[model samples]
Target: MPLVHIDLIEGRSEEQLRQMVRDVTDAIVKNTGAPAEHVHVVLNEMKKNHYSVGGVLKSDEK
Candidate 1:
């Protein structure tokens, strides 16, 4: 089994997230010969205020 973890800032539509996971799974299957059912994808969405860069929170930037 192959496990893939993806982290992104919150706000994407449900459909977009679903498509992202599907695309990831397809790539894994194509490259590693993993079965579709054996590939696991985990998506972690972070709030803008919870993510930061250059000492500034993303929510504070814009």
Candidate 2:
């Protein structure tokens, strides 16, 4: 089994997230030779305020 963790700023639609999971899982299965059913993808969405770049919070920048 393969476990994939993806983190990004929250904003994607349900469909987008679903597609993302599917694509990532497919890639993992292809690269690791794992079965599709055994591939797991976990998405973690973070608030803009929780992410910082160059010492500046995303929420505070714009």
Candidate 3:
């Protein structure tokens, strides 16, 4: 089985997130020849305030 992990900031619509996972799964399946049922996807969503860049929290960005 192949595992794919993904992370993104919170707030995307369910459909959008679903599409993203599907795309990742498709890519992995095509490249690795893994069966779709055997591929595992993990989606990690964090709050904007929990992530930072340049010492500024993502929630604080303009």
TM-score of each: 0.96, 0.92, 0.95
Report every candidate's CA lDDT: 0.96, 0.92, 0.94
lDDT of 3 at 42: 94
The reply for model 2, stretches above 4 Å from the true place, is none
The total number of steric clashes, by the backbone 3 Å criterion, in model 2 comes to 0
Runs in model 3 deviating more than 4 A are none
**Model 2 per-residue lDDT tens digits across residues 17-58:** 999999998898889899999998889999999999999999
**What total of clashing residue pairs does each candidate reach?**
0, 0, 0
TM-score of 1: 0.96
* Order of quality (lDDT): 1, 3, 2
lDDT for 1 in candidate 3 is 99
Best by lDDT: 1
C-alpha lDDT of residue 31 in model 2: 92
Could you tell which candidate, 1 or 2, scores higher by TM-score?
1
Residue-level lDDT of model 3, residues 1-62, one tens digit each, is 99888888999999999899899989999999999999999999999999999999999999
Pairs that collide in candidate 1 are none
